[model samples]
Target: MPHIIIEHSASLDTDFSQLLKSIHQSTIDTNLFDASTIKTRRVAFPQCILGDGKTDFVHVQVHLLAGRTQTQKQHLSESLLNTLRTLLSDSVSLSVHPYDLDPAIYRKN
Candidate 1:
């Protein structure tokens, strides 16, 4: 019942491994659930369709699957957004979406 979805701009020079590690560690440190049970998915878009260059926006969506209390979810969302903002260049715009779902439906045997 715990899953995390993270989406970011493809243009950003991101270290996927490090990001995953950070999320994993944070989830564990929060003591909200079993670290092993945590599930995270990250997607980066190479090219995004923005509104006539009105805003340089990068969409980031994070879904916490299970064992996340309401407060925990809020904290995670904030932490993730802050992390991305710091990691990305100032020229690029960043946006984060907090979502949730059941992992069982997306799990692979």
Candidate 2:
């Protein structure tokens, strides 16, 4: 299972609901995790600061069971960022990171 958390500044506000949908779908498109097993959430900060305030930023963190190879995670990150970039403006900063969660400790209901 994989859970994707999207964090963005308020200044970059656009269609966040649609952005979330696109992210989730892109995660599925990676074929690394089942669409039904994917999870996504977004947090918007109203008073967040970015370097020089030249542009807003969006950071996506993917937490997955500790088993995926580097190549798989890299592909996932690249694909997610590419898809997100399309839904965002050129001035918006974007990044995607993947973290390996300890399968033994990651408990779910």
Q: Pick the candidate with the highest lDDT.
A: 2
**TM-score of candidate 1 versus the correct structure, residues matched by position:** 0.63
TM-score of each: 0.63, 0.93
Q: Once superposed on the true structure, which residue ranges of model 1 sit more than 4 Å away at CA? A: 51-60, 65-69, 102-109
lDDT of 1 by residue, 1-109 (tens): 3566566556666677777666656656666667787786777767776654523454556555655678877876677666656655676666656677676676655
Clashing pairs in 1: 1-65, 1-66, 2-65, 2-66, 3-65, 5-63
lDDT: worst 10-residue window of model 2:
46-55
Model 2's TM-score against the true structure: 0.93
Q: What is the lDDT of residue 59 in candidate 2?
A: 93
